[model samples]
Target chain A: MLQYSEKVLELFTNPKNVGTMDGDDPHVGTGVIGSPECGDVMQLQILVDDQGVIQDAKFKTFGCGSAIASSSLATEWLKGKTLDEAMAIQNVHLAEELELPPVKKHCSVLAEDAIKAAIEDFQKKLEGRTDKAELHSPRCCEKLNDCEGCGSHGE
Target chain B: MKLPIYMDYNATTPVDPRVFEAMKPWFCEDFGNAASRSHVFGWKAETAVAESRETIANLLGASPQEIVFTSGATESDNLAIKGICEMYAPDGGHIITCMTEHKAVLDTCKYLETKGYEVTYLKPDTEGRVSAQQVADEIREDTVLVTLMLANNETGAVHPIAEIGKVVREYRARLHSHLFFHTDATQGISKIPFNVNEMAVDLLSFSSHKMYGPKGIGALYVRRRDPRVRLAIQTHGGGHERNMRSGTLNTPSIVGFAKACELAAAEMENNVAKLRHLRDHLEQGILQNVDYVKRNGHKTERLCNTANLSFGYIEGESLMLKLRDIAVSSGSACTSASLEPSFVLRAMDVPDILAHSSLRFSLGCYNDLAEIDYVVEKVATAVRELRELSPLYDMALRDNTTGDTDWAQAD
Candidate 1:
């Protein structure tokens, strides 16, 4: 049996905001990161306002318990923080907070990476609008093609 | 909640308090090398080792002279299988064994295959029980030895060794004129009755840790009458275990093992009865609560303490995660890294998906009825939840969540 941290086990058994959110909502910044080979996949959606402050966050994870718990904790920490503050959430810090063992620390790293990737996508979109307003108007949806939240490829 | 309820008894066991008490003195003031035959200090150590050897021999109904100690079951198995092969290398150059045997036996056979020797790997039925007739059928003109395990570690399927022994005896007279039989009875000594005479086996292996004793110690039983049951030493060192195994004997561990063997001989009947009852209770409870559950191995020939089940559409690892508080095993612990289903299940012809979705509960003497009931409920709930979330289940049922599948009820 894999030894789970008490906090991680608690979070896994009773995860918060376990379902999906509407990523199209204007108030949220959605983060979805996954590598196909590892099979550790997750979808994270954080709702944020014009002030760059996160309002709400939700996730749907499809991996081990540590992966689920790590993603859940990442979302909970994202709420009430600015985009820059949320970007600062490191995988090592989350691992320390959850008391994850060395092997499971990768899960926390994945969660941290997901948050950063999501924020980077949001920043790219905002920057594209300022660089070329007319070109960026209808291209926001087109930009989503490169950013696969959770990286799940539909058959 | 008692935090963790350990159910991986096959891996190892907690030392019994009685055995620990018996060994405490040997670690301190009584510590002396058993090999030293010069003075009073050596005499005491030799006496302790001899007495322990006698006590262990008594438990297995073998003479004290026939008992030879080794590191553990793995070493005992290696010494018994490889040792005999090396000794008879010039003569009967063949070995026979089943596919479901432990890695100790299987790997040894594989290594022997690389050497110049004929080997036959017999396959068992769906129940994992190897037939005695199968052994008789596989025997060749120059077959030297037949090494089979008394019971399987995963499914707890007891082989027909007694019947196999009868066949071996007949073949012994025809072929090499003295074919020896060996059994890795590591998981069978105390859990079940094992009389070498009744089984007619030349060599039998037993592990101390399997019966609530300390680790790193085990013994092999060699039938005294069989002069042809000779084996070459696998290692060269200071002569020990009549020069077959070489190492300064671990006196404290030997003493603990002896005491544990004695206790097991005295309490095995009661312990087995209790374990069997608790095992059945848990099995019945799970069947009553959960649907689509399939059992693996023989219905009646299964060990009294083990119950293996397959809950379709859900992986056992995910189910184990859900029921983290209950500490039961699922397939091979090593295979967890690759997430491959148990090879034992595959050998039994179980489908890959169903094999991955299996779990095993091996009850111990310390486990009570309450723990069994509690675990049953927890396991049922976890299996149900995992099944509900499984896309495979959804596809199999064609998205019909309300209509219950009859597969569970039939099983």
Candidate 2:
């Protein structure tokens, strides 16, 4: 058996922010990374507020203790962070904090991927809403000053 | 029951107290070299070694002279395969083995391949069994050796050694050529019925640690009559083990091993009965309590003490983490350094996902019904908890509700 660190074991045994968020919720963006073929899969979801701050973070992972701990730590770190701050969370930080062995570095990478995927999904949803609002009512884009990057601000 | 219950007997078993007691005196008092012919201490050590050899031979239904002591099963396997291959290189250059064999056999066969020896790796069936016909058909005139394990270490799948032995014998007779049969019976020694004569095995390897004996000692039973099996000396020193294997014997461990064998011989029937009962209860309890679970290996042909289960949706390593107090093995890539699940399970055509989800619970003599009950409850609860934390489980459930159970097919 592998010797797991106390922190890794603790996080694995009592992972924070476990369970799922409504993937269909507009305020929620879900990121699913890794694959069962590789013997790990992580799903991380972030609920963003109107001001682009992460209101809540939840995750579910099917992998080793390291993988579970990585994602659990990711969720705990993701809550209350802006999308940019969430994106800045690298796998190295998780690896260092968890003191994962070299063989388990991929678990931290999976956690990082899950975070990026969640943020991208949230941005994509926001873009979709902006596009729909623009198509329906051009004035709605004006009312929402966040349409600068929507590529039709001047038009 | 202990807080951390040991259910990974297939990995290695704790030495029995009786066996330990039998070995205590040899470590210090009778520490004289068995090869010394002049001293009384030497005579005493030699006598003890001889007695242990006789006991071990009696258990295997072989002559005491046929047993060759080695460090452990790995060395025995190395000696059996490499020794046979090197000794009979001129006679034939072909060998046969299964894909699911332990690394000792498989890697040895691979080494032979590098030396231009042709090795036929027969594929096992879905249940992890290589049939006797498969062996017969693969038998070539130049097939010098056929090495198949008696039972797989991972799934506890028992191969039909006697039937395969019969096939090898018939083929050798038909071809009128030199052919030898070897079996790594490490996992099957005391757990199942095995006899060198009845199985028609020319060479057999087994370890003591696997059978509640001391570690670092094992034996190889080389057939001495009917068709005397000859092996090239792998280790050359002091001309020990009748020159087949040359090294000073591990007297204390050998004594412990023999005592373990004696105990196993006496208590095998009752022990097997109790182990089977406990193992069956554990298997059934987990199966009934947990959904999306499947048992690996042949239902009837597997070792009675081994239960290999694949709990879907939850990865094995994660589930194992939850059941911290329950010591078991998993076929998860994360558990291994190579990032691949058990090759034994893979050879049996288990899906990668299910292989990642596999857990092997091997019961032993020390385990009791109460321990079994605790393990079963713990496993059930752990699996349920892990599944709840598995996104795949959530997706699977959603897919089931929608009557589109093909979500797993996406991967």
Candidate 3:
């Protein structure tokens, strides 16, 4: 039998936030990774604020106990961090938190990747809004005095 | 400490107390090489060896002259399969076997295939069983042998060897009638009846370790009058076992094996009945307490002491780790590498999710009702908890039928 770390076993025996949630929420960023062929799958969701800070996170995993525990622990850790903070979270830090065995380090790595991936999605969407605002600036419409009242500038 | 339950009877068995007693003297004061002629040492060794051979032959219903001893069932299987192939290679050159045969037979067949012998591997259906008619259908004019396991190691599904043998005999009436029938009876010896003539097998393999005897020893039964069956000698040191297998016999282990066979023969009916009762009780308890559990193998044709289950949505390795107090095996103990599920289950077309969740509980001589009950409780709790945490379970529970929830679909 594989000897699990105390924290991994604890989380495995009593996993936290282990169910599906609404990933389409305005505040939530979703990250889904791993294939069924690989024998491990995880779906992570993070609730973040307008200020790019994470308020809460949850996950559902289809894998061995180590993978399940890693996702559970990863979600709990990401709940109070800023998006950048979550982005900076390393797989090693998650592994250490769970004391994961070397063989199961991949599970922790998956957890970290899912975190970074979700945060990056939020950052990308934030950047898209800024780029759209800049493209429609009033300074660029100086010659068009009635541009404010004109919802459609051209037919 | 509580005695850890021994459910790995297929791996090896505890030496029976009586067999151990019979073997004690041969290890010490009476030790001598049976082949050393013209001395008290030789006489004593010869007497012990001959008596042991007679005891074993009686159990198999064969003359002592037909039994050839080897290191174990592995060597016995090798000597039977390869030896026959080598003897008739240039003239006859073909063999037939099932995919579910033990490594001893399968590997030997593989080696033979590489050495220019054509081997046709028959695949069993989803139930892990093959029809005798299938064997008859596959037989060709060039085929020299038909070998199948008397009972499968993982599923414990018994093959219709006697029927298959009868078909082979009818089809190959003459032409050297070079067709030989061999069954690896290692798993079937004590649990099921094995009459060589009744089974119509020309060659049969039996091992001691699987039947409450010492390891590193076993025997092969050959019909002395059969001109169609003879092995090309592989080992040639001192020409022992009528020049078939050549090694100085370990008297103590063989003696223990013989005694174990005698005891098994005597207690066959009683033990089979008791083990079946205990086995069914364990199965019933799990079925009563756990949902989405499935039994593997043929319900009626399976070994009396064996049962395998697939705990839907739970990994077998996790369940095994949780139930550390009890020892058990997954399907194909050798082939089922860690977390890989089982090849046998895969061949049966069992879905990968459920295959990975399979567990085997094999009962033995020492297990009783108390042990069975305790195992049932631990397994139920562990499987239930494991299933509750599985996302696959949540998806499966929705339909109440466990349809493949895009589980096997690769992304």
Candidate 4:
């Protein structure tokens, strides 16, 4: 058996914030990372408030005990943090905190990737909403009528 | 019942108490080098060693002169493969083996390849079986040796060695060439019926630890009649074991190994029946309670005490961690230093996902029905719990598929 720290074992046995959020919700961001072929796949989701603070976080992982513990601890650390603060959390921090050996360092790397991907998804969602709003606005309509380069609107 | 149940007997078995008792005198009271032939102590040790050799030889249906003791099965395999290759280098330089063979044999063949020897590694079918026809087809004029295993360690799939042996013998006679057959019977020695004569095996390798004996002792059976097998000595010093293996005999472990063989031969039938019943109960319970579980290996031709299963949508190491009270092994890459699943499972064409989810439960003589029952309950519960936490399981439930994600997109 791999020597795991007490904290890692505790989190793995009774992980915090483990579930799925509505990916369709504009306030919810979903990040899926890793591959099943490699024996690890993690899906992390976060519910962000209007002020861009993470109100809730959840994760589901199919991997080793260290991967599960890494993602579980990632969710616990993500709750109530700002998107920037969550981005600041690196894999080394998780590896150090979990006392993971070198062989299990990839699990922490996956956790970090999941955190970044969720933040990117949330940012992309905000940008997509802005674009949609601008497309339906009177100003965008006026610009569309004047611009011949807007081929879809001209047709 | 013990809190942590042992079900990984394929890895290694606990030494039997009776075998230990038989070996205790040799460790202290009869401590003398068997080669020191001038004294009473040497004579006593030599006599004990000869008796142990006779017992081991009897179990394998061979004479005492044919058995050559070594450190363990690994050393025996190296000796048989490399020894034969070097001895017959003048006649031929080709060998045939399976991809699912143990590393001891596979790596030795690989090392031979570096020395300009040609080796044909045949792939096994989905049930981890290679046919005799395949062996016959691969035999070339230059093929001097055909080495395959009696049973796979990971999946417990028994190969048809007798048929392969017949094919090799036929080719040897028809072509009037020097062709030999060997089998590493470490896993199948005591669990199944095996006779060197019936199998037509020229060289056979087996270990004591896998059969409830002390570790650090094993033997290789070299045929001395019909078609006498000559092997170039791999170890050269002091001329021990008839100038094949050159090391002082481990008297205590050899005695323990002989006792283990005697006990296994006596109680094999009853033990096999009981182990089969317990193994089937465990397999059935898990199959009935869990979804998306696939049993690996040949369904009917497998070892009675082995059950290799792949539970979908859950990683094997995660499940093993959850089922900590039950000792078992997994094919998952996460369990090893390498990032690949068991090569034996891969050779059998098990997909990467399923291979990562595989577990091997090997029962032993000491395990009881009640322990199997506990394991079943624990496994079912742990699988259910892990599935709940697995995103892949959720995806499977949503789409009604096997949760197989395209690797190109999953990245």
Show the colliding residue pairs in model 2: none
Report the lDDT tens digits of candidate 2 across residue range A1-155: 46899999999989999978877778898888877777778899999999999999999988889989999999999999998899999988999999987667777877887898888888888877422111112222232223222222220
Q: Which pairs, if any, clash in model 1?
A: A27-A48, A28-A47, A28-A48, A32-A149, A32-A150, A33-A150, B292-B408
Residue A26 shift from truth in candidate 2, angstroms: 2.5
Cα lDDT of model 2 overall? 0.86
Say which docking band candidate 3 falls in.
incorrect
- Name the regions of candidate 2 deviating beyond 4 angstroms: A129-155, B401-411
Give the alpha carbon lDDT tens digit for every residue of B158-193 in model 1. Answer: 998899988898888766454778999988888988
Ranking by DockQ: 2, 4, 3, 1
Tell me the RMSD of model 3 versus the true structure.
Answer: 11.8
| Docking quality category of candidate 2 according to DockQ thresholds | acceptable
- Give per-residue CA lDDT, model 1, range A11-58, as digits (tens): 878778665555544454455554312334456777777899988878
Deviation from native of the Cα of residue B326 in model 3, angstroms:
1.8
In terms of DockQ, the best-performing candidate is 2
The residue-level lDDT of candidate 4 at B138 comes to 96
Q: What is residue B264's positional error in candidate 2, in angstroms?
A: 1.3
Task: Find the 10 residues in a row with the least total lDDT in model 3 chain B.
Answer: B331-340
Model 4 chain A scores worst on lDDT over the 10 consecutive residues at A131-140
- In every candidate, how many clashes are there? 7, 0, 0, 0
Give the distance in Å from residue B190's predicted Cα in candidate 1 to where it truly belongs.
Answer: 0.4
- Winner on DockQ between 3 and 4 is 4
